[model samples]
Target: MTIEITGSAQWEAWQAKVLPPVERVADGLWSIPVPIPDNPLRYVLVYALECREGLVLVDAGWDDDVSWQALTDGIRTIGAHITDVRAVLVTHHHPDHLGLAGRVREASGAWVALHTLDAAVARPGLSPEERSEDIRSHLELHGIPGDEARRTVDLLDVGRALQSPAPDVLLEDGEEIRLPGLELKTIWTPGHSPGHSCFYQPDRRLLFSGDHVLPRITPQIAVYSQTAGDPLADFLRSLERLETFEVDEVLPAHEYRFGRLDRRLADMTRHHIERLAELRAAARETPGRTAWELSARLAWSRPWESFDATSRRFAMAETIAHLVLLENRGELRRGADRPVRWYPAATI
Candidate 1:
């Protein structure tokens, strides 16, 4: 069953499909709804934790003026200015999560902290050519034609990394946040991103599930230039780690706050199992077909042709992630060729 906090303004706003009002979740803790431009998720909930020195934020929203305004204005609700923010603990390197950390640092001299692995590639790389090559290579792996892939790469929004600057501090798993009046521990959950983390406040019994877990929509786990091997396996193992946590409520990066994380984790796992089964069937029916070809046979929220280049890129990456997982499980064999194809391991 989905867990909902009793009479939460966030829940009401979620139902209304609008931005939730700023709420003081617990003593010395506040949740701010900062807008994300043109995203269906609407807003990212930036949590401000009070300390003797000043306020420390869990995540910052997008770098747009509107998002910055919402973040600053939300901070004002708790009688603090943007300048009062002393530190920012980033959840991951996503534009929606770590975008404004630089601006926040400029305004408040706040130190930004990100996981070591994510910090390595979170900053904008030096060469666009390298990025284009990476995109071409990625597309080729999924059987996208060279000319078509080039055109698609030209249109894809690959500049997202520009908003995420490097962090001031590199975080490690199980490390305690030493800010006054709080006890937040970093839980390294590498799946959604190589260095995604969830903050656990043991004293308050709250878990800040940054994109690692959400109330509704499943977090996208896809293969990309920054992604390492078998992200699906990493994601499932991370879920198991989180299942051991004892918490009263889960404060996700997006969506409203909820409880019963165990159920959510189980449901996400089941969703992946069903998805993998569908992909397995598709592979069996069209053995030796490329991942790109098999992707059309799988289920998606919308029709395949309706997806634009960026959306299709995400879909293809997600499909590759699943295919790679199946291969790792010894259920499928990947062809050793450019524009790689998949075949059933049992038949091979």
Candidate 2:
């Protein structure tokens, strides 16, 4: 269950109290703080790129006065104003990524560009037909009750009401986007989200990795909908593909930006494999058990306890996804009851 924060003004209140003053981290890039209270993951990073055509913003942060101010001031630090922004590129549809998109567009008249797949999720103001029922089905298959599943879906509204206009440009995988002075290639990296794309600059050997690959933590991979294929498997394959690219430094959405891309990629790849092993061991001892039961066995951060329904749903979906991955790899197996999945260490 989500720990609901009561007060309509709380989101804005926390933003004003915690948003850090804007600072430029690179010649053409800036880091704007977006603070979230009652959660450990507290900040969002906004990258601003100035080109002859104008500015290209990667990831629109939270929709709030503080967040807007932080972004606007950060842009001004490089001698550019919000009105100078030419276009916005969304890494994904998550609230933190698309929050200020509308405001940015309104202020600068910038056209928004996002992957078509992710755009579907950011559209929450529509009727039931617009939303995917597959998300609910995925949760139910993992043994989450109807009421809990419904509540989780409802919490998606937390950010929906704040969504900006749909993308002015629909991005496709493998498309090369050239905005006057910038050359960015869209690399389709599913798993985190169906159509999540990472922007890569071949000449600079730089990667703008949204939530695809973080500096410190693993991006949550789960079955949110009747999403195509195995998400965890897709993620592993995506990591392998990323190693093929020559990324000298990665600019992630959270945490500090760093160099040595291969090592960081290796670290991320190893984490999931090791996690799969741990899940295998845990399930071996318990054998026939439900996904929910196994989820309780795993350790989560203390701060996660206060996360809302959307967060909890992500946690549970990720847990089930790992278990399913192991099962698919012959490391574990599911029984007739569906919920009764068993992990036999000997099988591995």
**TM-score, cand. 2:** 0.81
**Residue pairs whose backbone atoms clash in candidate 1:** none
lDDT of 2 by residue, 1-348 (tens): 111222223234345654444556556656555554344567676778768977898898877777677678778777888899998888987767877888999988999888998777566454554453556666666667778877777656533533456888999988998977788999989889877889998977878899988766789898655455678998888888898898877877766566766777788888888877778878888877677667767767645557567767777778778877886887777776654455564643
TM-score of each: 0.96, 0.81
Determine which window of 10 residues in candidate 2 has minimal summed lDDT: 1-10
Any idea what lDDT model 1 has? 0.88
Q: Quote the positional error of residue 171 for candidate 2 in Å.
A: 1.6
Candidate 2 achieves a global lDDT of: 0.74
Tens digits of per-residue lDDT for model 1 on 1-348?
A: 666563278888989999999999988989999999898899999999999999999999998999999999999999999999999999998889999999999999999999998987676464667777887888887888788789888985667665467799999999999877767999999889888999999887799999998988889999876578889889999999998889889999888898888889888999999999999989998899987788777889999989877787788889889988999999999888877899999877
For all predictions, the C-alpha RMSD in Å is: 1.5, 7.0
Backbone clashes, each candidate = 0, 0
